[model samples]
Target: MNNILTLAAIYRQSLFYFAIRAMTILEPQTKLSRNWHQKAIAYQLMQCFLGLCRRLIINQPPKTLKTHLVSISYVAWLLMHDPSLRIAIICYDEALASTQLRKIRQLLRSKWYMALAPATRIRKDKDTETLFETTAGGEVRALSVQGGITGHGFDVIIIDDPQKASLAHSETERRHLEELYASAIANRWRNPAKGVLIVVMQRLHVDDFTAYLLRLRKDTVHLNIPAVAPVDMTFHLDDDEVYRFREGELLEPERLSDVVLEELRTAQGEVHFQAQYMQAPVKTGGCPINPAWFRTYTELPKYDYRIISIDPAFTENGGDFSAALVCDVVGDDVYLVHGEQVQCDYPNLLRWIETLDKTWKPDLFLIEAIGAGKGIWGLLRERDFHHVGTIETHNGLPKLRRMEIVSPMIEAGRVFVPANAEWARQFLRLIGSFPYGPSDDWPDALSQLLIRLRDACMRAGQHRCRRFPPDPPPQQTSLRYGMHYRKYWL
Candidate 1:
């Protein structure tokens, strides 16, 4: 009897030990496997329950027992210590939330749990799948991100897998969850000072809920554990305990072997694999141009030709920015000298264009024919601006496809940008984030310049510039003539 009591005392003290024992009782069919990552996660969760960390975010690979450790065992452990604690477990959907709640209830109701923490009994009148209460007034509510929690409040909120991987690409779905967090979920804490908010999930998008929360809360305690270690580092779990991870080490070699990881990588593709397993999400639809591919220049080199490319937006407010890039073509390389993106009306946009032209003194001006581009082109011509031309895109080619066509030049170190320019930083960010980013105006304008430059070089019989064959010429009738009898078509 004394030995059993001692074991129960130990279980109540250490969450990690309690998790091992509880998981055995809950899942008797599967053999329990131990890993240090589990201990690391439990330690952080314990910190949250103790009020050491108010906001916590844990980003890890999928199916590594994140939900089991965080949603089930942690909730039950918290109740064991204080049955009056009100907790909420939230998931992407009601089904997931209910599933987690059921597991917690099972663990609480087990004979082993009854022996260890008999005081944390479920109230007979308040037992349900989605919500239940203890005899001491402790409440556990299960909810989906789409559900409402207006009338109730929680002392501890656990958001587990609040985003579905398949729907991560849908902007509407991502925005809806973000809006819910900002407006509803963030304000539902019972005690603002003592409440805890914990988020645990695999990364799905660059702008997913995890990213959104981190941006809003700079003091959030982030525990990022990838399936495979990208570098050798030491994680200080506690004052005396530290987990040292070596480079290229598998997070759990027993379950997720190198062979299995390879298979998953092949099945999920590079973009999904990097996001889900590595916990480093890139741009959606696979970023065509890698940011590291572009060469950097501190000063402009001697250039033979210079042109300005513009991608204009129709609206002056609450829409895409009117973007322009001034590029210099020196021999076979293209140097991005200056760039700007602003939200303004047509008159201001025209003035901005005139300013760029006069400052740079470019040999040609290539403006996209869509949106406000035609208006800008006609007005520039009326103003007698030299070497003005409108770029006509092929009907069948999409923006993504056009970017893919010009990516080789960037990858070959033929594209250059200022090393320390603020505008260059913004330009690279938009280019790197591409379709997944908020705006594509910068990339669109840059792609127009590269495509046109490539075509011109091909026409001049530059063998080194023939990375891709030029698109068949557009019909002469479809061509838009410019001043000085010059021809312009893309």
Candidate 2:
């Protein structure tokens, strides 16, 4: 009679049911709120389980129990249905991977779970923290993102927060992880055509792995849920059902009240809050200088001096980019002639400098005296490039502060740039998003040029500065200012 009762109580078919039941055991003390986000994720996982979604990406605010829902409860649920499902959960490191593994192991041993699925039991001989198997042939593996997955093929691979928040901004780390996923995780599926890959994490940067995968694969389904809805977003769960969120609506108001969110927004700053909680990663605009302040020029005016400022990459690896800006300074107006940023080794960097020097024939060259810059500067001197000069440092002020000192000059229209140059768009984007943009090579070079120019002019007693005529009403939004404008020449 007890065996029949246990078999009758088993709810092994529905992942949502199993997740809710497991949640009661995992988060025993807290009052868990089953919100819309959970339902949406459950549906998406169900689709993956049913062989509908091959590649799934979940982008949501952090501290929302995503790992629990997708990695632990969901995996346990899947095992109950098909104990033969080979699963691997990958995280930033072994510790994180093991943490989730422990949770799933605990949930599997809970009395509620045993009562529901009495037939499913973890094999005692194969039981371990990071790897385990069930009596019915299912297996679960936990490993780090950088760890190798040799001789192992998984039916469903779940990558939970594959990157640490601190390292997400590093291009080298991002690239390494992206390559790791492509070479290691993505190809480890037992069946290439029918295998499932699910990634769940908060959006870190615009160029992070999540963005990279979305760009590389066109068919991947992306589900994004922000803390507060920015617009009326209709999430199509299926042909008949939809999860619609009205503008300004909170994702889980019952648990994360508006007051709590507002406090977070205040404490963390709007830029961070938007990226970390709203899932809308934006390059915040507290930059000391605005790109709109610099006037555009159609043709170069007479120039007394041509100068090129170089900010060399810190490493030989293809990580930080080497940037060079060519400028023509006539009186007080500094015209930006050209700019370029490229990932190159020291040899390529030296070749690039020699080429720019030969082509532009700038009278002066200013290079930052740190990292690879110092070596490049020495090489230029050894090669008899007498124009090269190291930029003077100011008592170790932050980059933002150094940029701040030049903000007034930029805002006063002392800098003139080509109106429709192809490179100008990229330069302006970097400047507009200054200090926060993906790369700082351009901004650093530009700032170095301006500061050196100002100091040179002041020392030479060339006090007269030419201000370009007022720009005509813009015909279209200027890419630099997020609005259109017409160009003017002095």
Best by TM-score: 1
- Per-residue lDDT of 302-419 in model 2, one digit per residue for the tens? 7866779999884565688889999987876789999988777778778888899878977677897877778888888888775677876645556775675577677767788899
Collision pairs in model 2: 83-138, 474-485, 476-484, 477-483, 477-484, 478-483, 478-484
Tens digit of per-residue lDDT, candidate 1, span 247-269: 99999998899999987775455
- Model 1, C-alpha of 227: deviation from truth (Å): 0.9
- Lowest lDDT 10-residue stretch of candidate 1: 477-486
Model 1, runs deviating above 4 Å: 285-490
In terms of lDDT, the best-performing candidate is 1
Instruction: Report the poorest 10 consecutive residues by lDDT, candidate 2.
Output: 481-490
Could you tell me every candidate's TM-score relative to the true structure?
Answer: 0.60, 0.59
